[model samples]
Target chain A: MTTAGQAPGQAQANLIAIPRDWAYDFLLFTHRNPKPCPVLDVLDAGETVSALKQDADVRTHAPRYRIWENGELKAEPENATDYWRDDLVTFLIGCSFTFETALTNAGVPLRHVDQGKNVSMYVTDIQCRPAGRLHGPMVVSMRWIPESLVDMAHKVTALMPSVHGAPVGAGDPRMLGIEDIDAPDFGDAVEHEPGDVPVFWACGVTPQAVLMKSRPPFAITHAPGQMFVTDMPDFAYRVG
Target chain B: MTTAGQAPGQAQANLIAIPRDWAYDFLLFTHRNPKPCPVLDVLDAGETVSALKQDADVRTHAPRYRIWENGELKAEPENATDYWRDDLVTFLIGCSFTFETALTNAGVPLRHVDQGKNVSMYVTDIQCRPAGRLHGPMVVSMRWIPESLVDMAHKVTALMPSVHGAPVGAGDPRMLGIEDIDAPDFGDAVEHEPGDVPVFWACGVTPQAVLMKSRPPFAITHAPGQMFVTDMPDFAYRVG
Candidate 1:
């Protein structure tokens, strides 16, 4: 179940849980690659509740979960309470969906949402700065914006740097080394309107890509588009 | 000597080198309390070179260094190359002086610089948000700004949150638990102009205050105002 356009003005976050032993490396990783993984909240070991959302419980809040063992997906559970461990450190990363409200409010059309599909996401050739044992290629979410509205979308989202801000690449799909625009590594393929150009923004899934490469003993994360709806307004992180 | 008004437009940073073992906790500490500790760069263990500056060495670049042994000042040396350790992870924090160049360009009168003194800093009753084993009261740098331009000062610095952004408090020292304005916790007191008001901004000297309380086994930081000058312009960190 995608949380796309789920809670209106409220923010949504991608959640990742890892063992306490590997938490430091993960924290350092996010700091080094902030654009793709802007940390919204970090819950210390055994802390079930999120600092960003007081009412949410990490163990059971998200609608779906992906449980991983040594970087291999072992199960897709509805609630992670059964797999929850005392030594897990949870990180809530800012999701691009959190800014959809502002885009919609500003009159920037979202083609994927109109067609009832997930936004397109892909693994890029971009190498993220390494931190300790965590390092991997950056993952980015793609949106097809009209040539006229591209600058407006960029300026609006640039104001909120805490979320994935500004386009990493706005024009060519080949520049980031993605061979085919039709085939995405994650999320759905969407139909584009006339005069639309592909725009890429750094994605929260970059950490999951890192986890796959690093191969921590165990990990858990929200399933695709199954974000934790936060209480913060979209403008809550508006720094400008 | 202070880097104040030195290298007019280039960025200057506060250097803090701590052992690799405690780097995680310190990294988390800065993330939790970002207003005072905006991390510009975190060099891995034994990294004497800064990513922000190509021609600088962390061990010998800063004009002065403070060697801390379990929170006690062991020495104030001219260079830290002698005290450099293979296990040290250096953090370059955003110094407020970085924005002073912009403030000066904006015609904001900085009384401390006018009087040839270090900006006055104070330890406030305001406790910083804690993370792991690191927690302490916030330290603030005060400047006397003309009441008319207070809003302009706020807008200019707010654009650069990486540095201590905007004023924490613009008036009434009593609100921040600063007793006796004439006597400051750090730096020399400055005289205010006719229409000036006491304005406090989050300070780079904050981590030094935290070091006294948390008491890590070993640490190294730049001496007062002896910032390691970087090649990047102040606008490099400007998001808006």
Candidate 2:
């Protein structure tokens, strides 16, 4: 979620769930395509407890909820009290917002934050390693990094592998089958300075893309930039 | 599996299978516990083909195999042809040997290789992020590195996240609940020099540990030091 204007410990709860039978398949899909679907936490079927946060409720904490049926968005409800099912399983996926603080702290500028727009995203020709009835091309978010600071940005983000670590590709949009950088599939495109390079990182939107393509019977996900806030610090995701 | 003394492209294929219904759960388990269970490739139910290699069969390639039933060792068959089932699914998990070559090339010596013994491993008090019916304390392998080269060893292994990534803990065995470094739970313990620091990494033995603890109805894994070799190179696991 966009951590741009939010305080460090602000409330940004968002929740998603799927049928219990499909829960294992969904977890497998995320595992097979980890960069784009890093799992932060998972709740067993019919469970309301949040391992990442103490005494947190998934059904009502999120400021907003989206209902999806057969790959179509059907409602934007204030809470999922009526939709809650005993057979539903919840998963807390890592979001790019988890690394934004580290990136900014390391002196890497973010164009989306500066311009007040969602990060530009594109669908790539790269097919994700498929797992059981789920397969689709990867989706990546683009950022313009000063050529000199690219390595610093990479290092800063690489520290947190849980949140789509490092740039998948940099300096060329064509390599990812993006024909026009200005015309992104999702989010708004921002301009790059003369010395800036187009850098791309795997986006969480990739799972949404797979859902749209595979058309699972039922599913739910956080709205773009609307993530569930966890008590875990960004540093917790870093590796030695 | 140990890469020492084995021919580079030799037949080291080992196979394991579980019920078709548990396939997604098994895959999800590996995905949830990636460091110790790096999945190299997976075969669809009833299929003998490997996406990572051409003309490879999971049932017969490895020099050895071990069978487990309801969490207990049942057999050590040379091949699984007699046990093959149409409903079985095969997965090729990433082995630490994938990163051993790089570690050596970076000038870090491996004690297990020098002593011709399996690397030392221990079951830590750290519980892994669980998936479905699988949950257990994390298991790790121990290696002694020259104090000055610990950073280099970390960076070398960090590049390959698929193969357990960097050391989870180093220099302090007590932090991981290891009462005595010399008394490891698995593999052979090696002596450490005065200036050598003990580095611990997520081990493939972790899934086995989970299997033993959770008592899954049925499960199979490569024997320690006996892994499924793939056509993919070690470099393939590296990231920027």
**Candidate with the greatest DockQ versus the true structure:** 1
Q: Give per-residue CA lDDT, model 2, range A1-240, as digits (tens).
A: 344435452323234587887776677777667788777666778887777787777876555666778878777676777777888888777767677777788898888888877678899999998877778889898889999999998988776767888889998899999999999897788877889999898987787777778777877666656567778877777665
Docking class of 2: acceptable
Deviation in angstroms for A73 in model 2? Answer: 1.3
Instruction: Write one digit per residue (lDDT tens) for candidate 1, span A28-88.
Output: 8888888998888888899999877898798788889999888888999989999999999
For candidate 1, give the DockQ. Answer: 0.65
Q: Score the docking of each candidate (DockQ).
A: 0.65, 0.33
If scored against the real structure, what TM-score would every candidate get? 0.97, 0.85
Model 1, residue pairs in steric clash: none
Q: Which pairs of residues have clashing backbones in candidate 2?
A: B13-B62, B38-B94
| Candidate number with greatest TM-score | 1
Q: What is the TM-score of chain A in candidate 2?
A: 0.89
